[model samples]
Target: MKAQTANGFPSVQLVVVKNGRMIKNSAYGYISTVDDFGEPLMQKNKKPITKETLFDLASNTKMYTVNFALQKLISEEKISIYDKVQDFFPDFKDKKKALFKGKSDITVEDLLKHQAGFPAGAQYYVNKKITQKKKTDKRQNKEIVLELICNTPLIYSPRTEVLYSDIDYMLLGLIIEKVTGLPLDKYTEENLYKPLNLSSICYEPLKKGFTKEDITATEIRAVKRTKDEKFKDIKYMPVHGTVHDPEAYNAMDQVSGHAGLFANAESIAVLAQVMLNGGGYGNIKLFDSSVLNLFTSQGNFFSQAGLGWRRQGLNNSYAWAFSQLASADTIGHTGWTGTLTLIDPKEDLIIIIFTSAKNTPALFGRNLRGKYEGDFYLAKNYGAVTTLIYSAFKNYDNAMLDQMLIELAVGRNELINMIPEIYDNEGSRKDLTAIMESIKEQSKQSAILRKFLKSEKAAAILAEIQSRNSKKSLAKKQAEGQSK
Candidate 1:
């Protein structure tokens, strides 16, 4: 907490769980040091952060809203990951069919893996006023945003590459609503949160009766204007007890797939614990073990991502929130609003960090670096804390070390080049080689995995998976037709 405060972020809430029990739940720093207009305030104007302080979770909302929603639907057999985007919203079939042939090829799996080829995100909210002629038709905003996403040209062919995108998850949220006939928040609350007994997690906390005092303040809209021209002269206000992402706040009205949920550390820890327990907590089973495995396993994509969680791999940097010593199967995610959740299944550990760091001037071009340096500080703080936590567990066990060696040997030759930091002795080297030989003999995906390892192209492997799935689906349909 002190490191984060000294770096830039003012407030932080940390929760650590080991073996499904909370070991640490604490808060630090003030929620705000500046007022709504980015002006420095007196000490009396500041509010100290606490354990219960609600935080604008930003992209972390994806895990609870889009990811969990999809998992629930899949477990019910309502949808398959191989289902195409065109299958959900057929209106795209008639709209720009020739220009965007890739749209029809994009699958639910593509979006979940961020291999759908959508651009990162657009300031759709800023242009909404100019784009919409009828100002009073507020309900059409969602449709308009969807149209914008549909009209967007693909950056690459579907399943050809991985590009982390908010647009992908935005569409996933819409799919959840379309399939379940419930708002994203409603479905999650009734199905996931209620069962878990987590009452503190929800979308749009202010509308849900949370007071301004109960939630931490985020960025001032005015400060954001200096960085992006889209925000210039826009109605400025302090973000308190509300979503922070511009698209979620302005376009989606605090209900979006990519962002817009608010939560506290304790509630987030509960959710993480459920994930660590393989989709169950106590008597409640939100999903089957098979579903959890499918979602948390390493993807065939560029980033080693599962459905919505990022799996630890050799490519991951030390600045990442997960420990370097963590097993490859570890799954977790980070939020843009200074939040992190890491679940180490092998270690039976969960770590949650929530902060309102954007409330400080450092996030708005007022820091010593003279620009938004929050990302760097956020990574540093999260990485340092995670390292400290894992370090407490003593040396890495043989299983953990073996997994690291396999990962490094498979796709991370660069790490192998710097061997002293990883392999201390010739004995470890011989052990790694023997492990590799054993893996070569035992693994079923060895051939395919070797191809991907050699090529170092995650997109190619994932695309192959998609192609094979499509062929199987077509063959199944034909067989059914013949039987009938």
Candidate 2:
């Protein structure tokens, strides 16, 4: 792990895995809080965030739904990769008109790729009827979802352009329920987690390992006495311990197919390892490798999609685990609340980044204003390897520099030759320097790169050349400073 920060959140955890083993597992920031409205809320010594802390994994829940659907289909041999959404959910019939102005057809493949013509958000939270129900009454989430889709309009035909929609996955979840006799949660728990030995993952809050205060607080909304707010007190209503996303919380009764998955980084790692193992983690085969490959392979209809996972390097951004150093065969997804799990098949690696930053009222509503409807917002920064490499080289530590460069070379041999040039170019050099300065204090492994990244022994001949060039540039800068 490298570069963990609150960034105006309670806590965050970053992790790195290679060969199915954790190379770094680090935590940062406070876990509990004190004052809410000028008085103490949590009265104990603040517990620090750990890798085991259960985070609100907002949209990370999508992977589970996809996995469950795929697993069931594979089990029954009822569907193929080329299957269309129209095959099962014929309700998408206006699907022909769902395409963009000048596109082809929309496939199940397109929805998975996020190329479907649907907006990224919906206003499911503000529905007074849904919230007005007694807190003890079980939410009729399935019925609410039915009404939402029945009422909401489709933005465009499928496969038009890349527009993310929670409704798309929610529809898929409904499809899963249609195909399988059981509820989505029950099917997932019995089929997905039970088989994989994943005990900690869940959509609903559990009583054993958590409490009302254990969960992170997300937002603070202004309260109104009436619709006109003529008699309302001007104070923000405390939003803590509850699921922050209204549509997602409403979808699954706080346990939806698209969002509201709660799990620690460790449980996430186990799920990722299943993907790494080609649908089998240990002795158990969750699905055959062929089915796994089908899920991970991009099809002709969609430029970048596996069955449920998005292909890596789409839009120059990783759909998961930041951007990886591995091949495009990599697959993963990101949650709305700063949770991400990325799997790299080339290196057999899984990187899990989990944070409760979404629950912080400070950062929650800031970015959610302009276009997006979801009130939750999480920073998209990911995998710190590039920053680590740049830092090691800039600090002039020959050993640490050589080690990281060698690792990078081993990870991807082509990038090895470009190292010196990358360090020599003014723009690249400055970027590396800046990144190194920013992350150095927070990570001990990163600190090692600062001291020992120099060329060493017979293997580091390239590093020797790079070091000489760096030294010359440093001298020129120093001379220029003196002149100034």
Candidate 3:
């Protein structure tokens, strides 16, 4: 396998798919190194990272937790997608009056959609309220943390907004356990993984045969690195083997619902494939196809949300490679551990890219830069839309322009959404193409379009769109010319 820097940091594997099959799969970078503390983590020999070396999936575990809840619901016909949390857990109704004045208003739908108004992360992990002490040798710790989280107050009312919260999933996971009388991990194993043949996936930490060398690494946090204050100022260092995300680590009783699920590229691909199959692999229906669609459905008031997995569209676009496909109907999740899973239903394909650079302090701090680079976005669209924007400019058409703007706006508003700032910048490409698509779709209305439209402002919007388009063209041309 060949490796390359996605943003600036070196990564191990990069894979791609199109129309339900693999297109590209390559590997790069070293797997192990000697640390500053003299601890040797990762494969010391320049071993090639394979499809089976399980990587800590970080927040991507949200998919599993959500699936666990869905499975429980399937087992019991009583489960309604619209059922509010208060109905199931009445204690939540009035427990946190200061926050969730009416927890009954929050539905299971809201929990998965992130519209429950829970903060992204609750600081309870490091707080004294949650005990880290080992109580009951063989007892699972999630039950203990579940009690703590249920007692914690909601940060805001439900359904008012979508705020990413692992706490929300943690509570949801606990609720699953409570209702089904089974642990989340056990339920998910019986329902999702084994049926899919995702043998490498596991929630527990790697024990004997598996080591840091067997997994891709991620996150460098401020832990017990030094006794002296002088060394405390240093940021992240390369972390391997152990889970580095404090939130996920803590929730798992130092491991969690938010993170800590580990699997390799192959296992992840299998999971993605199963999802693309719409809840079944061969003979088994892990979940109902409609239920799977629910998980991937985009929310109405919000951009998108069906169940645990996010929906396909511009509003929720997470910059996955499949996201930029011209007829893209792809959706997937990204993990805090430099992991990306993109599935295109239209194409019936999945792409899994996992990098270990997040394991170092410098790498951790530079995460924002890597995401902002938008390589996936560029990779997906740069080939197709480059000329469309310029064509829209060449012919001044407001009707065309209006259509483009509306589609792009809808893309931002409803589908694979980018942040406002980034959306405004790159969204122009989609806006331009949408105008062309809409204009071409409507011919008889061309007269009404002419009657309602002006000539000058239309040309101006077209010109502006063209200018941005032209710059990219010139850059591409120059790059190609230089290569020659």
Candidate 4:
């Protein structure tokens, strides 16, 4: 953690729960070294990080908030996954003179599986969006945003591709509100969060009485996510104590279905524990066990994902937060703001990591060093914390774990070489790839757990980590014991 914080992230919170119990929970670093305008902050102005600090959940809100509401509605027979989305909203029809296609065929299940053919996202926060006829106020109205999505042509036919999109959950959030006649935040708080006693989990932490110091800042300054000329406005400030996602913040008023959630590590783990507990934590039942099974199991369209949760599968490598050593039943999701949640019902384990990965300035912009910027952030981050958590238990196959680590090391070689964005120039890319290749060669030739990392020798050096649990090591007598 000390080494990771040395990069660019302002803070990180990690919580590991095993067998329905919190085994480890901790927070590190500061609240903000810079204020909401990208201006520098004094040393005395920054606040210390703590376990109670809330963080932007980014996309993980799809699991804890949207998925939770869907499961509850399903349990009460208020809705079915097969129900067409048009059934809920009376005006959810294709626009009369728009290029919209196949709007009537979208099912609730397609939305959950992210096969509804919505684009990955739209920057509704920008004054001028593509599908809109005219620029509204600085932020878009919720009704207008929904209308835009409805009018926008489906990028692909529904059920043909498994692209992840915030639009799916944004619509689902509305569905929850429509059925319960309550806002998304109110419904989740009344039914799930408040009942579970999750004190710090909610949308719009600031409006709920949280100070800036109590929540991690996402960006040192808000930057344009698009190249549109209208996005040239310089009024953007550093985002703190608010939703980092543009659509959730600017369109749906920071209470959208896809994002706009803030919670500490422990609160998320407790919610994850509900899945492990078969739909209830303690006596507070949120849904039936059948709902849990239906949501967490692999979906027919994409085995890599369940309903809203990403599951362990052939495509699991993209989920940097989930460990390959985990049981095949592991289901989890990550956020753009650097939050992670993984729940394995088969192992009764839950891991949550909250990080403000974008706390650094975006002068260089996007993945320039996203992973290198923080140990908890991107492709450069490797199989360490989660893998070590799995190693702590006596169950999983040791040989398989070792093999997974080897593959990870090899993956680092392949992944970095493939991505041209992380490097500054061709020369830098060659230098970095060469360094990775050297490390891989060394790791292959040596059985001893010598320097295994390109940077820190032992950092994520999992090749021989299982040796610590070997019987041979345990059988050795105490060396030079004074009180034998």
Candidate 5:
């Protein structure tokens, strides 16, 4: 908690559940110390964040708004995942749709899997003229935004590859409205949230009667301006009790399919458990277990993606959030605003970490390598906390230890190399060596160890560890020589 606060994120709420039981629920840090303009205010004036403090779920909203709603609609036979997008919105077949040549064939399933080939999303809020009009009447502006999406060119042929796009879910939200004759929020609230009795989950929470004190602050920025110019005399203000995504805030006014849901850890845990229970919480079954399976099962095209949820990918593996202990069947999602939820049905585990990292000065963007990077606090804190949680659950049994050894062995050299970069003290180095020696002693009596000792994996682990240690010794010698 202290490390996260020092890294700039002001608050963090965590909840962990196993086998439908709440194992842990805790909160840390204040909601905000700096005001809207990034100026520090009196500590007494700021509210300490609690388990109930609502956070902007950001893209996490898609799981509820699109995935859950579609499950209900499909169960009711009102719509099919295979339904063509042009079937509901005929505009795609019109003359203006020529730009998106293959869009007419894009299926609801394609959009759900984010394989619809739409550009990520357009910043419709960047248009000053449209911004002024949107401020006056957001409903009208939403229609304008939809039209803009319709007219935008496809970046690739439909379903050629996975390219996650907010436009796809935005269109799905519009489809929900078209099918149910209710706004996305209303439909979701009535169908999913209310039925499950998740009171803290909703869109436009302030309008729903949640006060600013109940919501964590996000982003301190001057009044929004057009891409072509700046806003004259506009003063910076903290974004509080409002959606933080630019398109969701400026264009949709805190209600959108891809973003704009606000929730606390308790409400989030209920939803996760519902999914884990095979689409029911107690007696309330929103949809059949089969429907839940259809959404969570990996698609034929992308093994790392289900209909709307992200499965454990090889590169961005579950270890990124749930640690190496997570099962292959685990599915989860991470929000741009420092929120993460992981559900492992095999292990009957659910972990939820919610934080308002965007409230800090670190903004989301890319690095020179073009890999997306931001909010070092979120990355570091989440990694450390998850490691601690998994370690706490660690069993000393041979099977579990063998599994842990396999993972550690895969990256043993890299892990040793990271020690110098992470710890500056000789005491820490000695501690690490002692821990390694303890593991080595345990491995001597294990059957799995004897079987794998001559195997390629074990040999690789030993060779890497030796190579890295030698490199470290040489580097230390060179540094000492330079000093002399």
Candidate 6:
């Protein structure tokens, strides 16, 4: 955690839960290393960060808010995943058949899977032309944004490809409101969080009694300007104690379904644990196990796509966000602000890593598309942390497992996922197919590979894997009443 803080982020909070208990919860660093104007601050002057400090959930809001509501609603028989977009909103009907032929056929499942064909984003907060009126009223502004989203043409046909978008969840928030006649925040609080006794997950925390010092700031010098050049003058500045997402702040006024939620580490751990428990915590039951199973289950058509969660598919996989040590059934989501939540039902484990990675020196345009060079933000480094966590579970050596899997006789898919040199090169993919077809007669491998494939050595690795997955251990743990 200290290394990650030194890398770029001012603060990082990590929470791990196992067997429905928070086994680890820790926070390090400060509230902000820089001021609201993006000016650097002296280390001693900065306020201390704590596990209680609220951090913006960013796109993680989609899973907890919109997806959580969808699960409950489906359990209540209020809505089905197969329902059409036109059923809820009149604007999604075939009004522009010539321009967008199949817009209306988009189902609730398509939106959840991010296959509804909407572009990754749209600037609903700002008008495109110079002569347009600037919206001030929050409610009226939301209406304008909704109309714009519905009128905008999709990038492709429904179920074409999984292009993650905020527009999908924005419409979902409206669907919740349409069904319950309550605001998104209010509905989730009453129906989901409050009942589960999870308080820290909420939108508009500044209005909900949280002070600026109580929440970790997402960005410094964060003046959100128009994406369209014509309205560059229209921008909001001095971001602090407010959402860093533009569409959430300027469009829905920090209460949208996509990215307006803020939460603390402990609260997030509880919510994740509830999912691990099959949607029940203590005496409360939010939904049945079937609803949880259905959402987390991998997509039939798109193997990588879960209903709303991210599925950890096998080799030649589309989703590799979770740890390689994570079981194939693991599901999770990440946020733009460098937040991650992973749930592995197979391990009865949940891991949360939240860092204020955006609270660094600002970057200008074109560079916005560039990657963060920090070690904490890189998948390779933090993914190693996840692997270490699994290693700590019963003191098993996963690094050895990974090394062996890479060195010897791995199947095609496992080899592809294990080696980036093979996975990233298009030609290497074709070469691998040929080599695997004639493995025994292929070119000579290193002596280490030959040694590891011996009967005793190979059997040791398999025994470790089988022991980690042993039903006898699971039965003993279950009999113990599941302690931390």
Highest-TM-score candidate = 4
- The residue-by-residue lDDT of candidate 4 on 227-256, one tens digit each, is 442423675667777787878876787899
Q: Name the best candidate (by lDDT).
A: 5
- Model 1 residue 4 CA deviation in Å: 4.7
How does candidate 1 score on lDDT?
0.71
lDDT of 2 by residue, 303-367 (tens): 45566676664443453344434456777777766677777787576767776543333322333
- 190 Cα displacement, candidate 2 (Å): 1.2
Clashes of 4: 1
Worst 10-residue lDDT window for candidate 2 reads 370-379
lDDT value, residue 331 of candidate 6:
81
lDDT of 5 by residue, 133-236 (tens): 64556456677777777666787778777888998888899889889999889999999999887888899988998998899887655355334333344556
Cα RMSD for candidates in order:
18.6, 11.0, 11.7, 11.1, 8.6, 14.1
The CA lDDT at 268 in model 4 is 87
Q: In model 5, which residue pairs have backbone atoms overlapping below 3 Å? A: 36-237, 36-238
Candidate 3 wrong stretches, greater than 4 Å:
1-10, 17-19, 33-46, 68-78, 95-100, 131-141, 220-222, 225-238, 314-322, 326-328, 363-484
Where model 6 places Cα greater than 4 Å from the true spot, the runs are 6-8, 128-139, 224-238, 316-320, 363-381, 397-484
Higher-scoring candidate on lDDT, 4 or 5 = 5
Shift of residue 3 alpha carbon in model 3, Å? 5.2
C-alpha lDDT of residue 483 in model 2: 100
TM-score head-to-head 2 vs 3, winner: 2
Tens-digit lDDT track of model 1 for 383-421: 656876786665755454334435534433323335544
Model 4 spans with C-alpha error above 4 angstroms? 6-8, 42-45, 95-100, 127-140, 223-236, 314-319, 363-372, 375-382, 394-484
In TM-score terms, candidate 2 sits at: 0.68
lDDT, candidate 6, 1-484, per-residue tens: 5534543447778898887778899997778877655667887688988889998989899988898888889888999899887888888754545454577788888889888888889878765521154555334656777777778787787776778888999988888888888889999889888887777778999898889899887666555543432323544333567788888887786788888889987887777887888887898877778999999888756665688787777651423456677887788788887788888888999989887766754433342332332222332234655765776785765456445334433443344456644232322233233222223222244444445445573454445334544755787789886654
